[model samples]
Target: MHILQPRHIRLKKEEAEELLKRLNISVSQLPKIFITDTALPEGCQKGDVVRMERKYEDKIYPYYRVVVGSLNEKKNG
Candidate 1:
């Protein structure tokens, strides 16, 4: 949402599945992102996958993260 921040998009269930298959990695193997992260899109919850689009040089690269509950919440809930 910021000028310098990468765009984050929450992937649907089917898309997430396809991505995992294409990458040959499970959701747990992907990087983790907290649900409380400011850049995460609304409605994101635990087990959701987010795609981040970052521009470098003349091309854009895609990065993925699996949403997890906040540490604090994990401890309390």
Candidate 2:
């Protein structure tokens, strides 16, 4: 799954694309955010935006964020 960071949140690519379709907007139109977590799931890469889904009670929410590299590892050496 692709990862994304947008406005203090992280999401997967599939989720992001779905959100774009639902919201009727492109990814560039969304707010800019960074992935602050270091222990992201495996295969998450730098510069990749991830889309995710959240459920609260009976309600579901979708969001996206940009993967600005890992806080624990250095992408550039």
Please estimate how well model 2 matches the true structure, expressed as its whole-model Cα lDDT: 0.57
lDDT of each: 0.95, 0.57
Q: Write the per-residue lDDT of candidate 1 for residues 9-72, one digit (tens) a residue.
A: 9999999999999999999999999989999998999999999999998899999999999999
Query: Residue-wise lDDT of candidate 2 within 1-77, one digit each (tens)?
Result: 33433223445667667777988987676653445564445566665666556656677576665566344545553
**Which is the leading candidate under lDDT?**
1
The residue pairs that clash in candidate 1, if any, are none
Compared with the true structure, the alpha-carbon lDDT of candidate 1 equals 0.95
Candidate 1 Cα errors over 4 Å, as ranges:
none
For model 1 the local lDDT of residue 68 reads 92
C-alpha TM-score for every candidate = 0.93, 0.44
